[model samples]
Target: MQPVQMTPAERAALERLVEHARGDTGQSRRVADFLLAWWNAGQCGSYDLTTAWGVDDTIMDDMCVVFRLASRANSYPETLGCGPQFEAIVRAWRPKLVE
Candidate 1:
């Protein structure tokens, strides 16, 4: 598990991307949080996220694309979390299955 250690500037940049999801009335926020926590806690097998989160493989992959965008060193924060590119994965996220 690799921890994501970032400088203040990098943290701020991630926050900027996060802001796009605030009050978004979509799955963007939930998915964004899940991916952030996943990365911060060290990425698991991508399939682990799919079953645990109740999202199908294609949907999970879509979320990953947005997460990857926000994670890039020079990504434009405004370009993440919305628009046609994210239409499919931007709905309310399904809850984690309680076993």
Candidate 2:
């Protein structure tokens, strides 16, 4: 049997995401920002957010959901949330200290 995609469930998820992004001090906001940055980087960037959070499966899953919903929004964070949570998203791009 072919699998069916539930539109109602997705809509509910988007609504929840909307509420989550409304608050900045949450993983959803960071993930949204990270995903947007990845898209802006041609969707081929290798920042690997998974490693940033020590391969947290929940975060990776949220990333997928955010992408799925945002891709359908006309403005996404540009106007939806006023702006992105972070100015940019990078992996281990910080300066290292020398002993």
Task: Encode model 2's per-residue lDDT on 1-99: one tens digit a residue.
Answer: 323343564545544544443454646445444554543445424345553373246555555665565565534344444233322222212112111
lDDT of 2 at 9: 49
lDDT per model, in order? Answer: 0.41, 0.44
Considering only N, C-alpha and C atoms within 3 Å, which residue pairs clash in candidate 1? 27-91
Best by lDDT: 2
- Candidate 2's displacement at residue 98, Å, is 25
Task: Report the Cα lDDT for residue 76, model 2.
Answer: 37
Candidate 1: C-alpha lDDT = 0.41
Q: Clashing residue pairs in candidate 2, if any? A: none
* Model 1 deviation from the true structure expressed as Cα RMSD, one decimal place: 11.3
Q: Which lDDT value does model 1 have at 6?
A: 47
- Which residue segments of model 1 deviate by more than 4 Å? 1-52, 73-76, 79-99
